[model samples]
Target: MSAVRAIEPISRGEFSKMLRRARPPPGWGKSIAVANSGGPDSTCLLYLLHEYFSSDGTPPGNQRNDSTSNSHQKANPRIVSLTVDHGLQSSSADMAARTARFAESLGVEHSTTKIPWGEGVFPPLPAPGAPFEETARRARYRTLFDEMTRLQANALAAGHHLDDQVETGLMRLRLGSSMLGASGMRYCRRWGMGNVIGGLDWAGVEGMRRWIVRPFLGVSKDRILATCEANRLEYVVDKTNFQPEVTLRNAVRHVVKYGKESAQNFPPKLLQDIETIDTALENLPNFDGNLNSGPERLRAFVQEMGREVEAIEKEVDEITHKGRLPSPIGTFLISKEALEGIKDKPLVQRALVLRILRYVSPNPWGSLRAQAKRRSARLEELARCLTTPMSALSKPFSMSSQVLWKPVLKRPKIVKGKSKGKVPAGWIASRQPPDLQNAWGVADRDITEPLLQALEARESEGDGGALDILFDCRFRIRIHLDAIPQAVIDALAAGITNLSIRCDKELYYPSVVLRTPKNELVLNPADNPTPKFPEGIAFAKPVDWVSIEFIRTLGNI
Candidate 1:
């Protein structure tokens, strides 16, 4: 690791400027939620946001004629402090209380959400190299988003500073990330646009659009500490950060703090490159227009794209509707004309390919990037084949091992009593044959592969019913109680009795069934039992599937 150039301390004015740049439009509403963890960075962020959004800082246009009124009495955008208690440490509850007090001192509303780890509401720590931090972070943000929704806040803010950004970049580099990942964190991103560091699986949750704002991305950690000291703010330090062996982030932090200096200053260029890429993506062939084109032109462009995209969507839908591809999983077929049409338009080709790949991939975004890098040569070959004349492409070809194309002559249709002339031959895209396994091996290069394997192992061993599987860090599967072995249930009952468990009354469980070792049973209140065992527990699968929730949240994006 190379030492990063020290960043200058941030002043309140500079902070305000950063906020102005990242602030959402007025239409998103003025309510903001601050994720306060009672740590230095977050504590400072809470103070700064409170001051910035207070009545004293209200715009002149909204001021009243009454000069004698108290500044606090004036109306301003509502600011709320949200603290999530992960219950990982003994001092977590105390920290939550302290954070609430601090928010009250600043006249900000505060709330705390507790994650019951022992109650099986939260997933267990992941296996090595499976992004444990990313999973925890997603769960934390999920809690925050729920709170924001309940509070009717349009935006949520966090305290991620320059040092954090540097660490993130280094981690992404180590992970063999694409240019997007190497570019590091953005000052502003959509509420759930999962980036390289943060796995995209959990980001597409509903009601998460353009709701997260990080105003301190440009400020250094030292500067944040200095601001806290200048204001005499109290903050709790997490001791885990000092233990470099515990996590990669801590190791990176130590290196950045003490490593020898290097001439390269990568962050500025990285950010610029990311901005340029974003501009290019926004101005794709279907979205060609100047930035200065007013909102009306932008709206018109969006509508036009919407119509065009829908046509493509309908075409894909029709392929499935025709019963040519019956199964939802595995290989599917597309018309040769459709493939040629996509080949003629570069952007459409990329979009259509990405869409098809995403349909079968567990980690769609990661898979897309990996396929692009690993199969670049094959992709180019396929593109050339598609553009060539049909007579020249008579031989079977493949886009990649995963996407195979074979030419087959289409039978000519008879018009009345005579044959209508030969119809152009179409192509079929399907999975490569088993003998060609080397051509398209299963995409096992993903970080989530090991985790998926572990889940499958558990399922095979019949332990899956007792434990919920966190699939791809995106979905959770809770098997029905009946599927669990009796011995497992007996053991669980014994443990619960030993622990003297006290369940939260307000906590909702979709399905709960308990049986004692003595053949006694205690079922959830909602259960409807059978006659054989009058007190036996009945099970009904819940309608709220985790995968469905993910799809609903991210929508069509």
Candidate 2:
């Protein structure tokens, strides 16, 4: 591992130094949203800003300047704590409500932006599966960004501290991240509402806004905890954080649990490595060229960049898990290359993956989720039968969103030679009932594709074939951030689609790797011979319903 093995304590002066370096480009305005989960890290940041304004050395109100000697509060930067209730636990809303009250006392105007409670955002949720966490995080962020717009806040702050940084860095490293991701959390990252896609999440110039800020990013959780204790700051304890099996983050936290180390004792080299990685990342190329392109072109570009990005990917992975800055420049190239590569796809998908998968596949989403293990394997074996194996492998070179969900009929009899089973002809994979969904009904299928000759085409939902497929269904639902109610979740359960139910509080998930139904997990397009999901692990259980947790517990898969 690198010198930045774990979260080390930091003195106020040291934190101050880090903050100064992280200062945003002035004009964030007076109205700010502090995304406080009521955790100590966020609580401490809110308090610190309030205290900064309250201090004697601070300049008079409205005197805005970077100087610590001339600190001032203009319009007092309305410090509102936006607590997102992802309704995974009974205590979730309670914690947020309590946080609002505590924030009110701290003089921070707090508002609970319950992210559209259960059955809120779309694409619906699958039953408890490994995909829940990643899906929920995206939902949570989508809500937060929407709230920032609704609240008209110029800036948004979250509670990511040193430990979070370490975790992120480690995750990025573990995930075949480009070096930029493995650099850990930054005090100020561009916004997809504080996402990796920066401003690329939206297409138009109007969408480019650096509205999110992470004030406590440079500080450690220990310092925040200490600050809370010192100032008598009260916060909720997320029990899941202590549980080792819930997520990789929790597992790592258990591995690098912190003790009572004073901020005065942080290692210099750790700081140095942080700086080095940061600097290297800063110097990497910004992908501004893919300004306009179709999905296919972007896919080709991403794969092309993958070869060039390997060196950095290796280093970030090394540093995150092994804890070492294997090669700074190499790491820089990886992130830079990919960012440049992915700019042409749907802004949301590209940004979502960039911000996250630095840790899943780091490949295009459509391509990653498509295909079966045995099919891909068989395809490879078939390739070996070609006139030139390498040239035949070129068929896999293309990626198409159209191909992502293409339901092809399988000619099993044609492939019976490859397998020991007596296969029937015309057996399509899509036609095979998904084992999991066997219990749940499917829903919202296309009523019609298009009536090219008729004006009524615009009024159609979709073709009858797909609609016929999903006659009726329901899903076990979970909300990343709370807003609506259990009733809505119930309605969805009763009305929507195929599902099984289970709820997990910590959906802090890993990047998704494609797992074919036949037991092949592809690490991502970024890696060679795709790695297996550790320990034969294919899917994770994403809690289906938060409401159920109030009454019972759903154990592991």
Candidate 3:
């Protein structure tokens, strides 16, 4: 690769263009918060945002553009600076104070939050060979998000430049990340209630999705430093960047900066390729020929597969009235006719099997690449078994520890003055298999014992009000004393063993299951009384349950 020319300091016009590219659509509110660490990159970002958004000022490149002055005035966004003092270093407080002072000079509102290390609020340190940096990052974001909520900010901007993107992409590539992960950071994304370290946390209140905009993502770090120099901005330098032994990121940075043959130094073509892959992924089922010509056939294949999946889902819905069964918790029933119809379509059959597995799996959002490979292997095995005739479907088979499928004979239905006919044997998929344990979240860590113990402890503590708990990252369980009858509560207190809870109606993905010591309660009423809550304690109206709020609380636990 030829030597690249040095990038010039970013002008206000250039910054504005970058902002346009990174800005999310309207309704995110005009309030913006900057993640300032008093470092050069973030400090430069704060300065630029101030210059552009300050009501009484004109930015460097906009001073002579008098025709657009009024428009610029109307476009001013409310800016605030948020500083997180991790307190990892002795000088961390000083750095935060400096950041506040700089924000004050720019006339932006500032707030500082210190992670409580001594209070046992933060999570435990990473294990050996684990990413300590990532653990710290999650803590930092959690703190920042708390402040952002107090400020009622809609968008949080970070100074992650082109170099940071390249570093992250290389790191993910090295770690065998999915294609989407290797594509690197997006310019703008909605921070949902997912992992915090991987840039998947909300800005304001939990469950209220917020925007995280990286306007400098297309600009280089050198250009940001140059911008700071050109404007005479004062910023603190983090010495930790030079300590390669402390974190993998610093090691990658060193290699990118000084190593002659380091793969960390992203070539232009490689960067372009990553972007192309990202674009293709984002525009799924829709591909243009102008981009990578090699993926056209692959793209066509996926599109066809998607269509097949949809058709299978529609047929299943029609046969089973939306892919669900009448009885037995966590069961999905498919008519024998529907299965026979798709038997000839091998791809469709595999797709149907995968869908059933996904529906029952507690962690639906498991690693995409791993899940795909597992599904392919399982599908092949299932296809071979399925070819042995309908009789083979009678035996129960495990998809995973948490999921199982079997064929059952359906009794004939009676019509007026006649027998309609015996319904053919159908397939049943369920998560309630005898050997299955309650799996939590995407990691699918077994939390059955811990959860049962927690509930028992809470009950013993005589906590009378509603207690919400997140179970297996799949559902939120709200145990409300007020919602239950006194008789059932007394029974629960009396130590009823083999208790079960069932919902009256099915909750969608990330479903909330209502449970008690004696009866399993669902959101909807069930035809039978065994699994559902007793009629006396049944809720007359649906409760507005917020899953994200439960997850936010779960983070602390």
| lDDT ranking, high to low | 3, 1, 2
TM-score of each: 0.47, 0.43, 0.54
Write the residue-wise lDDT of candidate 1 on 505-538 in tens digits: 1111112233344543322222222112223434
Q: Each candidate: what lDDT?
A: 0.53, 0.41, 0.57
**Candidate with maximal lDDT:** 3
Residue 184's lDDT in candidate 3:
61
Candidate 1 global CA lDDT score: 0.53
The stretch of ten residues in a row with the least summed lDDT in candidate 1 is 499-508
Query: How far out, in Å, is residue 483 in model 3?
Result: 15
Model 2: per-residue Cα lDDT over 1-557, one tens digit each: 66764443444556556555555565556667777777777777777766654454233344436554433434445666777887656798899898889888977666786555444333354354443666567666666666776777777777776557655654454544443335555566445212222221221111234356676654456667877787788887888777645565655454444321211233454333333433433443543222123223323333344333444444333323332112211111112223233234222222222222221121221122222111333333322222121211123222321111111122234454574443211100111122233223222122112111121332264432210110101111122223323443343334432222211111211122222334422221232122222355344332221221111001000
- The candidate with the higher lDDT, 1 or 2, is 1
lDDT of model number 3: 0.57
* Ordering by TM-score: 3, 1, 2
Off by over 4 Å in 1: 1-9, 25-28, 56-75, 118-121, 124-135, 193-205, 208-210, 260-557
- Alpha-carbon RMSD to native, per candidate: 15.2, 20.7, 11.2
- At residue 468, what lDDT does model 2 achieve? 10
Strongest candidate by TM-score: 3
Q: What is the lDDT of residue 401 in candidate 2?
A: 15
Residue 133 miss distance in model 3 (angstroms): 3.3
Candidate 2, position 10, lDDT = 42
